[model samples]
Target: MSKVVLITGASSGIGKSIAIFLTEKGYNVYGTSRNPKNIESFPFKLIALDVLKVDTINDAVNFIIKQEGKLDILINNAGMGITGPIEDTPTDEMRAVFNTNLFGAIDVMKAVLPQMRQQKSGVIVNVTSIAGYMGLPFRGLYSATKGALETITEATSMEVKPFGIKVVCVAPGDFATNIAAGRYHTPVFENSAYKENYQMNLDLMDAHVSEGMDPIEMAKAVHRIIETKNPKIHYKLGGFLEKFSIVLKRILPDRVYEKMLMNHYKL
Candidate 1:
């Protein structure tokens, strides 16, 4: 029997690409979006799901369980990005990002684990970002969400290993996708201190994301992660410079890393 896989935020971008790629490879794929109607002409089934809502998550999983008998893989890829300084970002706005990026991912993982535990085998992949490892200029909150998810993914792997469930984090650098269209640009105040630098950094960040790696590359990384029996706890998928930056951050001094970031972002 073909393995059953479920992915969240499947309306577009990396999530959508992964779903299509996996489906073409003969995995029984189910993708989720807040509105199933938005996913037009998808190869796999589009399940209505709002990751922030527990009931919708449960319903989506239950539907999959009923149809496939077991969920062999799950990609917690639903997330959003926001741009603003830490102080300039409103508490409610920060919560909204975390709601979908962190809490929502965890909630879905919770909903799916029982079955994986029962079956004694499953793969859970969380789509994080390169920003998770290093703080970005105006996208601090977005970085925080991904960073938190990465840590959670680590902890989850340790806890669930006995059940034969593998939890992995795939941190992709920028990719060519509609993510910028959905990105929340925090309101800039006329007299705000961070107005100039914030605007400059935000524009640069948007441009980088628009011209970054292909989404198919990320999809292929997910494919490899699922196919491998013993996948690593974390996988960084992106360009050479992007992946190199992670290594630099670990080896370089704090001040040097800070300077590199400031120069790159023109902060």
Candidate 2:
């Protein structure tokens, strides 16, 4: 039998691309969305699953287990984006993003682990971002959330290894997606101190997304990870500069790396 796969936040963007690709590859795929009903058509089954709600997460996971007997893979792709100056961004909004990106992803993993442990074999891929490796101007909250998830993935991987379950992170660079549309962008207040620089960085971010690589690359990477016998703890996919930036951070002094990022963002 083909491996049964579950992907969260599959209504569009990278998650949708992965769901469709896996389905075509003959995997039994179930994609989740906060409002799966809103989407009239999808290549694979779309189920209602809001990551913020534990009830919804449990319900969706249970429903999948009932239908498939076992879930062989989980693509924890559900996440939201936030962008603004640290001072201007609301603390409440920061908590909300953390809830969805870090806590929310953790909840889904908790819901799946029992069943995966029972099966004695499974793969869980947490879809993080290349930004997770380094903080970016205006996108600090988004980076922090993904970075937290990366650390969690490392801890969980070791814990679940005894059960023959694998947990890994796939961090993708900017992809051409509707993520910008869904992102919570703090408005550019005319009197705000960061008004000019914040707005400029926001535009730069959108342009990067528009010119980003296809989401299919992420799909391909996830597919490869699921098939690997002993997958690495982390896998990063992005353009040469994006991937190289991570390396640069490792080799460069703290202030030097910070300066390089400032220069890149024209901060």
Show model 1 residue runs off by greater than 4 Å.
Answer: none
> For residues 13-110, could you state the per-residue lDDT of candidate 2 as single tens digits?
99999999999999999999998877869889999999999999999999999998999999999999999999999999999999999999999999
Q: TM-scores of all models?
A: 0.98, 0.99
Pick by lDDT: which candidate is best? 2
In order, the Cα lDDT scores of the candidates are: 0.93, 0.95
Most TM-score-accurate candidate? 2
Which whole-number lDDT from 0 to 100 does residue 86 have in model 1?
84
Backbone clash count, each prediction separately: 0, 0
TM-score, structure 2 vs. true: 0.99
Give lDDT: candidate 1, residue 239. Answer: 84
